[model samples]
Structure formats: C-alpha cells, structure tokens
Target chain A: MNQDSLAYLPASKLARLLASGELTSVELSRSVLERAEHLNAQVNAFLGWDGEDLMAQAEASDKRRKADKALGFFDGIPVALKNNIAVKGSLLTCGSRMLENFVSPYDATVVERMKAAGMLVWGRLNMDEFAMGSSTETSYFGSTANPWDLTRTPGGSSGGSAAALAAGMSPITLGSDTGGSIRQPAAFCGIYGLKPTYGRVSRYGLVAFASSLDQIGPFGHCVEDVARMMEVLCGVDPKDSSSYPAPVSPFHAELELALTGGRPMVLGLPVEYFKEDGLDPAVRRAMDEVVAYYKGIGWQIKDVSLPNSHLAVPTYYVIATAEASSNLARFDGIRYTHRSESASDAVDVYFKSRGEGFGEEVKRRIILGTFVLSSGYHDAYYLKAQLVRTLIRNDFSKAFGEVDLVLTPTTPSPAFVRGERITDPLQMYLNDIYTICPNLTGLPAISVPCGFASQNLPVGFQLIAPHFEEVRLLTAARAYEKGNDWHTRHPAL
Target chain B: MEHIDIGYTAKLARLELSKDEQELYSAQLGRILEYFHVLSSVDTSGVEPTAHANPLHNVLREDVAVPGFGAGPALANAPQQREDQVLVPRVIE
Candidate 1:
C-alpha cells in the first residue's frame, strides 16, 4: 500500500488501497515527493516542484478518504505536465528563451480534465525548445539524462516527462507528440508513452508546435496506467476547435476488454522498417521476442508495406515547422513574456527581440519554415513535402486495410549518450525514422518496453494503429505487456 | 536546380554560428536538401499538395463572445504592463 517501489504498484491498486483505508493519499504523496526529491537532481526531469501545494491537496484527499467520500480514480495522484503544457501560474516555458518566464493564465484542456478527475498537478517537466529536437538536449533549460544511464539521453522532446516517470518523479507525466516526441523518448527511457490519434485529445492550452501533428498523451511505467491517464485526458473540447467532437470513451472500459476478451488480431510487420539499418541487433531480438509472444497468444502476424513511409520524415519536418513558425509567432515580445531592450526601431525590435529570445534550434526551424513558405520556395520545399505527406497518408490507409496493427522498433538504438548526436542532426533525425510516419498520417501509436540493450538501457517496440483507434493500440500494448515483464521493469535511479 | 548559398542559408537559419557550427550544419543540411530535392524529381504536377495528414475540414466554433484574459498574474510578471495588457516598446513604423 505504501507504493514505495513505483516499480511494483499499478495505479488501479493504489486507488483501491487508498479507497479501502489501507493507506492515505497524503502518505502516498509524501513518498513520491521524497522519491522525486531524491532522484530529481540525477535526471533533471522537473523544472519546478510544488511540494507544499501537492501535500495540501493530498491532505484534502486524506480528509475525504477519512470521511468515506467517493474518491475519484485518480484522486490525490501526483502527475507532472510537460513544460510546454499550460498549468495555471506555472512557468510554461516550451524549453525556449521565448517564454522563459511565461506563466499560463489557465489550465490546458487536458489539465482541466485531470483537475476535474481530482488528480494533483505536481509541476512542469523539461522538453526540447518548442518541441523541436529528437533529444531533450535542445532544451534551452539543458537536457534530461536517461535515468537508466546518466551519460545517455532519454530520447525526446518529451524526454523530461518520460524520464520523470521512469525515475518515479511522478506517477504519470503528460507529453505532446509531434512526430515521435512522446514514444521515442518513452522508448529511450524505459517507460510507456502513447500518441493518441490526432484530434483525439483537446489541444486547447497546449502551447502549439504544429497544430496539425501535435497531440497530448501520457507516459507511465505500465500500459493500463497510461491508458487510464489517456482516458482522463482524451476528449472533445469546444475551446480546442481542431479536437474531434466524438464522445470520448472510457479508456479503461475497452482496456480490460482488449486484454481479457479481445479477439486475436493481425499484427503487421512493415518490410520497410526492417530493410536497411532498421534496428540494432539486440533490438531486433527484442522485436522477435515481442512477435513470438504475440504469436504464442494466437495473434496472427503479417507483413504490410507502407510504400510511402520513406517520405514521412521530410513531410513531417516541413508541415510541423511551417505550422510551428506560424503558431510561435505569437511569442514576439510585443505580445508575450520577454522583449528586447536594445532595439531602437520597430523593425529592429521585430528582428532583435526574436533573435534574442529564441534559441538556436527554434531559430533554425523558423528560418527553415520561413524559407520553405517564402513565395519563390513555397512550391518547391513546402508543397513538395505536403505532396509526400499525401503519399504517406495514402500508404497508411492502404496498409490498415490489411491488418489491425503494425509493429516496429521505436528507436533504432537505445538511449544514446547525451550530446552524442549533437553534432549530427541527420543521424538524430533518423532516430525517429520509424516513428515519424505515424504523426505524418495522424495515426495512434504507443511504445511499450520490449527489452534491454547491453548497456542495460531499454528498447521499445512501437505499435501503430489507424487513427481514432486508441482502443486497438492500447489493447495490443496491454496484451504484449501482460505476457511480458518488460512493462514491469523500471529504471534503477 | 537552384543552389542555396552557404552565407544565405546561415543568415536565413539565423545562426551566428561559430565557424564550426556554420560549417557543420552547412554540410549536414546540404546533403539532406539534396536528397529531399528528389521530391522535385517526383511528378507532383497534377497532384494537389496536402497540408494536413488527416482529411482537411473546418473545425470552426460558434463565434459567441466570452470573457477571457484573466490578467492578474499575467500582469504581475510583466516587465511592464498597463491597463491589464502587456506593455511594449514603441512600434510605429
């Protein structure tokens, strides 16, 4: 009931124990707070910690528990929000100088939902600047090390959230995935991360990166906990115009259904994913183990090709950066957090304020976006990427016709040493090679622990489902998790 | 095919790169752009460019007026603020 070993207790059990009087929410909160404080410095996963407020909430939850009130499923649960996610009055820096001190006036739709569910919002975690890089190293705040190995990175832009969950800094952490941000980091850090189908969760209050590609999701050590967090966060929001209006299903309802009673379904292996420098030898072994386990459970496996998947990375960069440039323009000193003191004129201020405020990665992408969208270059760079995007989408639509789910190695390798890929951007880009295509096509994808590499770091197998198919994605993940103890394994802080 | 100047690209990329930073990204981006230029080689003449991965449609909401901009803390942290809005340096062109 103490749940000290974040490695041991599932969230559902914690909820049950706290409800049945075996434990109090305050005690659980303090245990996590103590663990977080002990391990946070090693990983640098959190940017802020509201320890006192969290305890206050826990005490309130305790009061409710003692009074025999109907405690919500996630009541008194301590969770962290990615720095890019707005938490009212919390520094919502999107890992950039642009909003270094920006505070949100209100909660994001996901935050509001979690708040309504009685979950405690603990603090904000680190991320890549404007969610740009494949590793958290791009963060203006500096990088988050993989809790599994301090020398290596927790693959990012959601690296902080993933690492926080891995180190037990929080029970779960919310992350936004734009082209593998969540899952890749989840893979690297040895935790569970999901990118729900585009439009599945409300984007309102999420600091925009690419309005089209970004979807908020959750990271946890286990599949069902991730699903529970997903159920609470996924929904329609009138404020988020781009969110789907479809009724949000109870992620748990179908979750148990998928594990216990769901039919044995086809799992597709895309040939392209395994063709070239596809996966490290050990990771390939991990994939084999995952597939064999699924086959052992009578699930049919097949090979399906997403022919245009090869174009996915380029397509994603152009579309995501183009949207990023537009969405981030609001951060100009005229409107938000920081402005320049040196510029004497309006034009000078426009250039200098942004120049001073944005980090190199943010500037690089903005300029890349500006060039791609400029009149003479528009049709060439931006339009070409968009065309390739169509092909990527078409390929997925075609492949989905053949199978219910597709599996691939999440990252080509386990967490690489921090600063290892700093000099080589393309190599870092390739880190997301297998994961980006899903975001390009608005598919729901989840990364669950498969096995550990030689360095004792974790490797992940990514399962992607057709859009709006969170149920199927979570089902396969839960299925794989139950038969394998990979999901049970946690990083030694 | 158009070639991007190293100087222009560096300026466009807004990097005051140390000689190494400039040289590194230049080589890296050049290779990527060259490979990506294959998109130019593809026949997309009649194909419509897709901006979104999902099907494109409007996500418009009712334009009813709602009160917003709770400026209490927003103004508190401002380097400067006036009348519940952010204050900025002079901007007349």
Candidate 2:
C-alpha cells in the first residue's frame, strides 16, 4: 500500500502492517498528519495538532518495532483523543470557547494508557460544548459538516471523532458519551462507535458533563478495532474511582465469540421506542430489515417493554444539566482561564465571561438546571426526575432478564441537513431519543451501520446490552455486520 | 394557572437575551416545563428516587500522592503561567 492508503487502513490493519515491517510508524503517522491538514478544511475533524511531537513519537515506535521491543497491539497506530480527554501539553478545549486556548498540563488516565500501549496521539477532535449537545452544531468552534454531504451534520459531541474516522483522517478515536454523543454521531457519520457500560472505562481527566452518565470509549472503522482499543483503555484506573475494578476481559478474543444456531442470543424491541409521529420510513425500513437479518441467523426476537421510557429524555436533561451546572462552575475567571475584558469587578467577570463564552444552547441548559435545583424547586422537578429515572432503570433490568440484548434505530430519523433543525431546539433534542435513555440507564450500547438512507447517508442499527455485557453486544454486532457490507460502504471521499 | 418569569430566568442564567430572545425562550421553555408539570401530577408515593446507577456509595481512594506531571511541563502550555500554577487577569470581586 502507498503512503496515502495508510490513511485508509483501520487500526487493526495498521497494526498488522506495522508489525510485519511493510510500513513503519513514521509512514503511518506522517500519512495521517498530511491527510488531516489537507482534508480538515472539508470536515474540520480536529481542534489541534502536534506535527513534530507526533513524528517524534512515531519514530520512537519505529525504533521499538525494529528492536523487537514494543507495547501491545496498538503500538504504531495514529489516533485522536476527543478534546475532553486531556493529553499533556495539548489544547483540550472540548469544543467550547470558554477553554479555547486552555491547554492541559497532564495526561488523562485514558491518554496515559494509550501512550503506554504505543498509540501516537495525533491531536484533539471538536465536540459540543462540554459534551452537552446532540449535534456538533452547538460547538463554539463551528459545526463539523458530514463527510457524506457537506450540507448536513456529522452527529455530535463526538462528531469530529466519527468524521475523522469516516474521512479516513484517523483510524481510531476516544469519545465520551454522556447522552449518546458517541453513538449518535457515529451513526450519522457512518462509522462504528460504542458507549461501553458507564464504568467500563475510566473517566479520569474527562472534563465532567454528567459524572454518572459520562463514559469514555473508542470509535473505530470495525468491531474488532473497537475491541482492540478497549482492551488497552478499559481496565480499572485508581485515578477514576468509578472505573470497574475487575480485570479487563479478553475483549479481542471475545470478538471471535460466534453467533451459532438456535437463539444464541435474544433480541428485544421496545415498541414505545419507535412510536413517534415523525418517524422516517427509511429508518423504520432499516430496523425491519435488521430484525429479519437477526431472525434469519436464528436469533429469537420479542417485543419488550420499558414503560417509563417516555420520561427518559426529560430525566436525562435534568440530571445531566444539573451535574453540568455544578461541574462547570469551577471554570470561573478566578481559575486562571478565560476572563472578560470589560469586567470592573470579580463577580462581573465571572458572570460575564461565562455568559459570553458559553453558546446559546449551553446557556439555556445552565439556566434550566439552576432553576430545577434552586432552593424551592428541587423537590418538584429534580426529585421527580430522579424518581422517574429509577422507573426507567427498573424497566430495563426486567427486560434484560427476559432477553440478552435489544435492538433499536440509533436515531429517530437520519442525519438532518445542516441548519435544518438548529432553529428548533425541541426537534433537535428529539434526534437522540433512541440513544439517550441507554445513557440514563448506564447500559452498554453501540451504533453499527445497517443500511443507507438518502444522499448516500448511512443508517446505524443500535444494540443495547446489560451493563458490562459489551462482549455479547460486540459478538452480536459483528454477526450483523458480517451478514452485510454495511461497514464497508464508506462515504465517497 | 401559574407561570415563570423570563426576567428571573435570564438573571439566573447570567445571560442577556434580548426582549425578543426572552420571549422566544420563555415560550419554548414554557411548553417544555408544561410537559414536565404533567409528569409531576402522576403519583409516586411508593417510588424510591435513585440518584446514581452504581448503587451510590462513598468510594474512597488512598490519599498518597502518586507522581504527577512535572510542574515545568505541566505549566508549559498554560496560556498564562506563574509559580508552578496558572495565572489570569485580575478577576474583580
């Protein structure tokens, strides 16, 4: 393969090539850096880059490979970390103006692991401000246009990560999923993204959005690549108290776990999930076909119920906003970050800097969050949402006891045309209905391509597994992908 | 019937949306809050309000200081830096 084809190699493939000496880490890293510089004007997948630093790291990896001393599978692959994952000395903006020039002094636990595993950190990708929005449109940096069609969205706050993968600018990336930020964009951008169980991966150094709901996971071109990256990044980290302490299972080996004859897995469909009036025929058609595909492979199917699910979106917003409001309070001007030039006093600077720095959607949520948690209203709104959240989780637990996994369309319709829904906030929030509830419940869910919709945009079929049951979900997802060429259909870049 | 004041919301949000923007947000938030109000009317006498999914318990970590980034490298990229820490323009009180 030529140097440019190095841009298109998946993480697993890139690793294989590097292992055999057919390609050096220098060739792979340089190929992608040049590609990112050239193609970034089109998709705007990155927020920052380190050309010299990347080359230095790649050369070191090449040395390790030559000496037959190296880290595990990911030793030479070029990957991007979502800006939320701090890499020492890199700008970690999280796509917000508030942190526009803020650079981190330390590596996040995930970044530390990525380096230890021999992966070269290319740069940071753009995102919704603080991982709060469903689309990258909420970014202060600007929206990332879909690679499939520059006129539409690439889904967010991990839109840049997925766009990078889809455009072949980067083969693997790390994205935080608070409320479907990873999967929604991955689906819209036609790549594979996973939201592992809430504690499956460490959250250390991820700028907090909703501490409980936020999880960091990988975005890759294929299921095996996600499994490979997860193996390095998933194990318990003392820095993050919430990371699961159990040994990181043999995820790479688990990927080969087959789907055999006769109900090897149970697939459940929650009828209420796809019941709104504005459902797209293309998405529904894709869902029906996904069901038939699984059935043909001898998997059992049933229509399960999550009765309180209708309340999930509101509940998610309440808890996420409240957590965000508190977590974001530390960014006040006193903290050595963005401050207002016009402030005559400390209080004014804090309020005004934050006021101007945050985007409109962010300001809206902060106000709503403050109102719901203020002295008099907590019992009425926040508490009520908490109670509803319990019912939602219980419903999923019961459904899981009856079936091993469930399938749903990752988004309500398909990727919306850019500038189409930004004017209508409610319509924008509804775009993630199918994916957010899983975040609220902390289940393991993924978006894998199932079919194409229109204008060459791909539709992702989603699968949800019980908390920490990612192996089962990956096995089942690979089964679905193996049956069709969904992952192979890249955008016409 | 009851209602919320947009002026209060703007002050709390620390945003200065114009009269037109307030009017727009008020109407939109009003509809959203109205739906939430309907949710409140439903009974929840026997329900337990869960806070987090991992059976919320106090998770404590050891207080020992492990190695962190060297202060020099840590401060290398701070837009403004001082004595091993970050610096900012004087925030008015």
Candidate 3:
C-alpha cells in the first residue's frame, strides 16, 4: 500500500495485518513517521518525535510476534502522546516555555502500559500551554492549524492529537480532557475522541490541570480503534489515588458485540443545549439528522432537561481555574527550567519567573483563579461555584435515571478562524459550553463525527454515558459509527 | 460584585502583570464576575459543595518507603542548581 493508505488504515485493520504477517510494524511506523514529517510543516500537529526510538520499538514488536510472544492486540501500533503526558527520557514540555527542556525521569502509568502492550509510542503532540486554553493558540510552541482549513483552529487544548489523526499522521493518539480538550478538538478534526469517566483511566502521568476534572482518553479514526485503546489504557493505577479500582472491560469484544447484536438504547437530547443563542444553524441541522438516524435505527429518542445546563460554563471556569491556581503553584522557578535571571530576591524570582514563563492566556487564568480562590472572595465565588456544580451533577444523575445516554453537539460550531476568538476569552470559553458538564459530573463522553456543516468542516455528535459505563458508551458509539461513514472522512492535507 | 483589584490578586497569586494586562484584566474580570452573579439566584442554601465528582474518601495505601526519584533525577530539570541542591535567589542577606 502507498503511504496515505497505509497511514490512514484503522488500528483494527493494521492489527490484523500485523497478526497475519501481511505487514510489519517497522514498515507501518516508517510510513506514519514519514507522513507526519511531511504534514507537520503545514498542520503543526506534532512538537517532537524520535524516529530511531520508534523504529527500535517497532522492530522489537516484530520480533515478539515472530517469537509467538506478542504482548497484546495493540502490539506494533504507532500511537502519539499529548505533550503533557510524561514519557520517560522524552521532553515533557506541556507546550509551555516553563519546562521546554524538561525530560521526564519516569514514564506516566499510561505510557508504561502502552509500552508494555507493545505499542510503538511515538512523538509528543502540541497542546495549549499547561492545557489552559480551548484553542491551541495559547501554546508557547505555537498554534496547530485545522487540517480542514489551515486558517482555522483544530479546537484544543488537545488540538495536536486530533489534528494528527485528522491529517493521517497517526492512526491513534491520547489526550487529556479537563473540559472538552479531547472531544472539542476531535470534533473539529472529524474523528472519534472519548473522555472516559474521571477515574476510569489513570491520571498518574498526566500533568494536573484540574485534578478532579482531568481524565486521559484516546483519539482514533474509528470507534473500534478508540475501544481498543481503552482496553489497554483504562484500569486502576496504584500511583493515582483517584483511579477507580475496577476491572478493565474487554472493550474490543464488547464493540464487536455492539456492532452486531446490541439492543437499541434510549438517547436523551437536552433541550437546553439547542436553545443557546449562538449555536450555528448547520450544527442544529446535523444534530437533527443524527436524532433522525438514531430514530430510524430503532433507538428511542426523548427530550431531556439538564435545567442547570446554562450554569455549566460559569461553574466550570470558576472551579477549573481555582484548581488550576492551586495545581500550578508548583512552578515557582525553584524546581523547574524557567527561572528568571533578573531576580534579586526569592519573592522577586517567583513573580518574575511565572510572569515570564507563562503565556498571556495562562497568566489570565492564574489571575482569575487567584481572584476566585483569594480570601473573602472564596466563599462567594469558589464555594458557590462548587455548590452549583453539585446541582449540575445532580441534573445529569436525574437524567441518566431515565435515559441510557445523553446526546448534544460537541461544539457550538465547527472550527472557528484561528484569531477569531483569541481576544475574547469569554467567547472562547463558551467553546466548551456543551462539553464541560460531563467533566463536572464525571461521566464518560465520546465525540463521534456526525456529518459536515455548511462550510464543509466536520460536526460532532456527542454521547455522554453514566460514570464508568465505557462499555455501554463505546457500544452505543459503535452502533452509530457502523451505520455511518463520517468517521471514514479525512481532511485533505 | 465590584471590580476586582487585579494588582492585589496578581500579587497574591505571585504573578507580575503589566499595566496593560492589569487594566485589561480588571475590566475582563469585572465582566466575568458579573456573569457569575447568575449563580446567586440558584437556591443552594442547603446544598453541599462537591469537591470532586466521584465520592472519594481517604485513599490509604500501605505505608511503604518505595524508592522514589532521588535528588539527582528529582532536580534534573532545575533551572539553577548547586552541589546537590536547587539554587534559589537569596532571600536573606
């Protein structure tokens, strides 16, 4: 197969080829790396990669297969990591100038798990600096362009992972979703992204953004690939205290069953999500089509109300930023790589280094976070937001009691122009309007490519399942994916 | 619900903002706080604060002194380091 065809083959197909000896992991890795190199200039999807290390891993995987000791089903597949995830001996920049040269001394648990599964973990994908912004533009490394339209953003902060998959640079990638980081970008790039229940996947190696909200997940060209990734990436990790102590599901097997004999499930459409004033007409039409398609497929569709839905954005910003202010306090220039040279005293060093090291958006968030968490203001802002958060979660809990899944538009619109909302942080924050509640409630949410909008950019149909129900979530997503070809569409790079 | 003192907040946060940033943030943060005023209308008088989404209690692990990254690896990324110690700007003297 030529480079494009080989690079764009779904993970399941590539796994079959590897198992059948029809293709070798080394060849696949080389083809993917070459494609990434060619497209990186235009798409800016990757920050750095070690081609030699990847080839070595690929060769080892091939040897293991030859010896009849293959690690698992994902053996030899080339997967990318978001910049924030720690991969031992690789640069863990988190797309910030603060630690641009920092190399991780130990692998994140997910990286260790992926390595043990024989997957050739290759490259650090770009993201918003410290995973702070909705657009990848906040990255000190630079913004990643949408593959569909270079002038537009590949929604972030996991823009690189989604853009890489959309550009066929890699078949699969992992990203962390605090608030729509994975799903929004996946929607923009027209791929499948899942933010598993908060503790479903280990956050041991993920740089903490909002500790309670952050969960690492996968981006794939298809639902089967995502499910296959979850099979490897999910489960309890002793290193993470918040990790769920539950058995990992046989997601691939479940997906197969879901593809064929799964019973139709009830889907809830929150009327509040559609009533937002700025929602694009094209997105509305695509959602309508998705509802119609599910109805035609014998699934029950019902109108559900997340009455407190309008409060999600405000509550998320308050809580996420408050946690961010606390979580980011470790970058005090005493331990990291971006200490200021002009400091005369310890206090001066702290202020100057943070001010210099952080980007504009990061600084803005730190200030906002600081304000909400400061004395006196804490009760009114932070405490109130937390109480409101419970209300939002309660809304989801009530809806799930009646419906098996909740559906909404992944983003209010398709990828906006790169510089469009950069100046208006509120407008940019609204990009996660429909997505943040799932994180707040700790539900498993997946974004699947539904159809194209008027501008021909991809639109996403989001499905949120109750916590730790990834099997049901992926199964439902698979059911939708099998009947549609939207996931098969790739951006013309 | 008045405008926040961005300078004081930045100081508390250990960040130094420029005049432009301070002025801009002062206005922007004022507007965002105004937006947050909507939360007051919700009757959360009896509601409990959710610190985390999942119900988590004290997660106890066996107290074992597992070997962690020693000083060598731990301080590898330090911007400034002396003999086996991170070199910070002198606060005394």
Q: Candidate 3 lDDT, tens digit per residue, A78-110?
A: 999999999989999999998888899989999
| Candidate DockQ scores, in order | 0.43, 0.44, 0.84
Enumerate the chain B TM-scores of all models. 0.60, 0.65, 0.93
Interface RMSD of each: 3.2, 2.8, 1.0
- Cα lDDT of candidate 2 equals 0.82
lDDT of 2 at A327: 79
Q: Model 3, chain B: what is the TM-score?
A: 0.93
Candidate 1 lDDT, B8-68, residue by residue in tens: 6445443334465456545666666666676666666666767665553887767799987
Q: How do the predictions measure up, each by TM-score?
A: 0.94, 0.95, 0.99
Task: Write the residue-wise lDDT of candidate 3 on B35-62 in tens digits.
Answer: 8888878899889999998766789989
Compare candidates 2 and 3 on DockQ and give the better one. 3
Off by more than 4 A, model 2: A258-263, B9-24, B66-93
True contacts kept of each: 0.38, 0.36, 0.85
Residues A268-355 of candidate 1 have per-residue lDDT tens digits of 9999888757578988899888889999999999999977766777777777777877776776567665777886765555556777
Tell me the RMSD of model 1 versus the true structure: 2.4
Instruction: Please identify model 1 stretches exceeding 4 Å from their true place.
Output: A1-3, A6-8, B5-28, B70-77, B83-85
- Tell me the deviation in Å of residue A168 in model 2: 0.5
